[model samples]
Structure formats: C-alpha cells, structure tokens
Target: MLVDLFDFALPPERIALRPAAPRDTARMLVVTPDALADRIVRDLPSQLRRGDLLVFNDTRVIPAQLEGTRGDARIGATLHKREGPRRWRAFVRNARRLRDGDLIDFGAGVAAAARDRADDGSWALEFAGDEPVELLLERAGRMPLPPYIAGKRATDARDADDYQTMFANEPGAVAAPTAALHFTPDLLAALAAAGVDHATLTLHVGAGTFLPVKADDTADHRMHAEWGRIDAATAERLNTVRAAGGRVIAVGTTSLRLIESAAGDDGVIRPFEGDTAIFITPGYRFRGIDGLMTNFHLPRSTLFMLVSALMGLERMQAAYAHAITRDYRFYSYGDASLLLP
Candidate 1:
C-alpha cells in the first residue's frame, strides 16, 4: 500500500480544540461492513452486545512539555522517553548548536544538562535530583498539547486536568489515550449497569504514534517503537472472557496494538512487557480485537492507516468523507467511532 492512498481533505473548522461539555455526549460513528450508522457516545452499551469486553490503556499523560533557559539560549523540550531516573530522551530546539556539557537552568535552582544522543535526533538530558523523574516532571513541566491547538498561550491552568483521562493512573505516556477520555465515571457505571466489563492495560504512548509515514510505500515506512505491558492477572482475565465467547474491544490504538502484539490465535494473553514497533496496515489480519472504540484521525497518518486495516480501506475512506460532510470532529479531543469487524 502507498502512503498517499490514505489521503483525504478535512476542513480546518472540523478540528475540535475542546471536548464537549459533557464528555459522553460526543458523537459516535458506528462502522460495520454492511452499514454506517451514527449515535451519541452515551449509547455505547446499546450499540455493543452484552458479551463484549472493552480493553483500555490506563497510562497517564505526563506534563512532559517543559521549558528552561540554557543561559539565554531559551530552549524548549519534551521528555520524549525515559532512560533512567537521572537520564531522559528529549527533543530540543536549536539542537545542532547544543553539544555535550551544556547546562540548562529551569530558574528554580534545579537544572539539567545535555548528556548524549538517542535515536530520532533526540537528546539525552540528565536531571539533578533524588526525586523520581515522574515527580520532577509533574512539578516542572506543562501539558504537551499537540501543535494544532493555539488558543492557550500557556499550558498551565485547565490543561492539567482536561488533557488527562478520567481513569488516568499509570504515569508514563506523554500523550493521552484519547478513547478513554470520552468515558466518565458516571458513564462507566452506566456501562457496567448495562453489563459491560472493562479491563485495563498499559502502553506508554510515545512520540512515534504522531509521526507521518515518511516513506512513499507503506511497507518501507518504519514503525516507531513504544513501550507497553500486559500483566499476568490481566492476561488471565482476558482469557476467561474469551473462553466465555465474549468479544474483545480495544479502547484505543495504543491498547489495540499492545493486545494484538501480546496475544496470538492461541487466545491466551501472556505476560509481555517491552518496546513494540508493530506497523498495522490493510490486509493485516487482526489477531486479538473484534471491536474498536477510537477517535477520528488525521489524513494519511499511521492512525488513519490502522483504521483502514480494521474497517477495509474502501469503507474507511467513505467513512472519512462522510465524517467531513456531516462535520464530525477530527483528531485528539475530537469525536469517536465504534468499529465492529
């Protein structure tokens, strides 16, 4: 498949900068091979059968976008990945000018130094503190919102809470697991009342997920690696659900990728933890999930490609056109879709 085959046009107004006032009120596009239906997110349980399991990624979004001054250099950085408590992989501006042994002060007596290089043109910055890196970032950094949103001048006040999912717990991801964001505590209780069971997994979303396929051909586009894990207990629970003939519905691409990467047709999820660079495109048979709950994506993105794989390319392209015509929201903090394959 060629990367350009997934292309489509979207109006700028269709991008949603903020979520709906009531989270569950967001629209849901229901895509089955034979029919394309639409409904509100609150109607999820009715849309899904009773014997379906929704798998969600509980990785919390960190305030990983940080700013500091390297002696008037005025640097900006995002803690892209963790190396050690004292070390981190960060993307910095004016990177070519920066060399080993450059000190950047955060203006609060704490600082970091550019130590080395990681792949993808990222830098290794070592921080000064006994506190864990997560805690340090929590106090120092700002919410790493995507570049498209521009109303907010500073990422301080509302973003700290709004950018995270209601069920956020495991602290690692720089980006939110968007599908989980639509579910409120009240909505979960309602879904449970309607006989749906929820299981949690962790896949620390990395910078790679947002990268466009630079290669002309899909086969040549290198997949970006992100760290993920599924525990023994969660694996057992999933197996039990499968044995009972229930369907597994992944809540986001992150969860879907990790679940599919960890389990095969044997139908047992083993305890697996590590980096996964799995590139899923059309004609790739899905090994784990039967349903997917996800947000609408950018044109020609890896996410769009993943959607093309789930609901055939023809169906997906039509769906995107339909979404545009009906003025559905696009990208993170946008509307969602429930896919049954």
Candidate 2:
C-alpha cells in the first residue's frame, strides 16, 4: 500500500510537550468497530471486561543520548541496540564528521571507538571501559526522548520520571513504551479491583521507533529489530486466558508486537527470547492480541500502519480525524487510544 495513504494533517499545538498530571488523567479515545467514545485513561477498568488481561512491556528505558566531541568536531550519538556488553549500534547526528575507527570522546572519560558503519548510516560503537557500560551511560547519557518532544524543548529532570512507566524494571530500552506511561499505582489497584488481570513482557524499545518512514510504499520500509522476551510461565498464562474465553489486551505496541511474534499460526503463544523486527501493516492478520492500548502515533509512521492493520485503514483514518478535531494530544508524551477491532 502507498505510505501516503496513512498521512494526516495534525496541528502542531496538538502535540503534547508534557504528559498529563496524575498520569491517568490523560484522555483516551476508544476506537471500536462500531463506535468511538471519548474517555479518560483512569476509566480503563470500565472499558475492559473482568477476565481480560492487559499485557505490559516491562523493559526499562536507559539514558542513551550522548553528546561528545572528536578533536574539533562535535558529535552526538543515540545508542539504539546493544551488540555486546560494551558494544552498541548508534545513529550519529553528524555522520559526515566521523569515520570508522575514529575515537569519539564523550566527557567524563566515557568514550567509544566508531567501528563498522552500516549501510543505513548507523555506526557500530565499541565503548571503552572496565566498569559496566550501564555505569558509563549514567555518567554521560541523558534520557532518549522522542524527537517530537525533544525538538520542542530540552529533556529535564521531570522527563527522567515521566518518560518511564511504573512497570519499568529490566533495563535496556532506549525508548519507553509510551502507552504504558498512562498507568499508575492507583490505576493498577483499580484495575485489579475491577478484576482486570495484568502481565508483563520485555521489549527493549530502540531509537528506531522515532525514525520516519521515508519510503513511498509500505513494502519498502524496513523495521529495526528489538530484543524481547516471554517466559514459559507467562506464555502458559496467556494461553490459559484465551482458553477461558478471555481477551488479551496489549498495553502498548511493544507488547503487542512481541506477543504476536511469539504466537504460532494456530494462535498459541510460546516462550520466546530473541530479537523481533516484526513490521505490521494493513492486510496482516493478528493472532495473539484481542485489543491494543497505545499512544497517538505520527503521520505515515509504522505505528499508525500497525494500528491500521489492527483496525481497518479507513476506520483508523476516521478515528484519527476525530481525535484531531477533539483536541486530543499526540505523540510519546501525548494522550492514549484504545483500539478494538
């Protein structure tokens, strides 16, 4: 399909620069097959059934944005993927100034040697340190905010907490699963009291999620691989939910993609531990999840394509139109959308 088909006009003011206070206060636009309703994220319990399970991505966001210098040239790097304990694949801001084998010095003695440059323009970076690379990042890195928000303002101490979800534990992700940011402890307790069971999976979201789809067609767009894991116990529990005739509600696109990647043709989810570069587009059949809760996405983005695939393209287009007209927020620090097809 033509990528232009997913394009929509969004007013710049509608993009949220900051998240709603009391997280759950964010507006949620519920898009169902037959109806569209405006609701609050706190009203999730009333929207879902008792037996339904909400799967959340537990991958924690790491401080991955680094600004440094090599000689006189200023360089910026955002680590996208972990190649080894000390090696990472990063997208460079000023690629023209760096070369393979160039030593870029990130202040505080944190530096890395640029290795192979991939065809996509990202460079393989090998960090120099005996201490864990996580420690090095703590000293030199800042939270990797989505460019939509970061471009408008600088990342601050507030974003350190705002960009992460309450379920964040296993650290690796460069980006937070934005949809899950609406959840809070009070919301979780309310959900449990409302009989909504929840589970967790890990998908280390990379900076690739912020990349624009420059392709003219959906077929030409390539998705970056992200590491994810689903344990046997969790898979068995999810299967049991399906067996009991309960719906599996994915809390974010990250969770949805990982679960779908683990599901078989027969629709049974199995234990999985590896990388997934699953690119969901229209005409794709979903097997694992019954519904999705995610943030409003960018125009012509892979995430919009995923939602278009979940619901029909026309329906999502209409839904987005309604969202825009209703003054709902957009992007990572934006409002939420509950999509059920």
lDDT of each: 0.84, 0.95
Residue-level lDDT tens digits of model 1 in 1-341: 98999999999899888887688999999999988888889999898777678899989998877778876578888776777768878888767767788987765555888987666678889998677767777677878887666443446577777788877898888888998889998888888888788999999887666666778988888876788889999888887888888888999999999998998777567778998888889988887788899999988888889989999999999988988899899778889999898
- lDDT per residue, candidate 2, 1-341, as tens digits? 99999999999999999999999999999999999999999999999998999999999999999999999999999999999999999999898899889999999889999999998999988999798999999999999998888888999999999999999999999999999999999999999999899999999999999899999999999999999999999999999999999899999999999999999999999999999999999999899999999999999999999999999999999999999999999999899999988
CA displacement after TM-score superposition, residue 128 of candidate 2 (Å): 0.6
What lDDT does candidate 2 reach at residue 97? 95
Candidate 2 residue 33 Cα shift, in angstroms, is 0.7
Which prediction has the highest lDDT against the true structure?
Answer: 2
Evaluated against the true structure, the overall lDDT of model 2 is 0.95
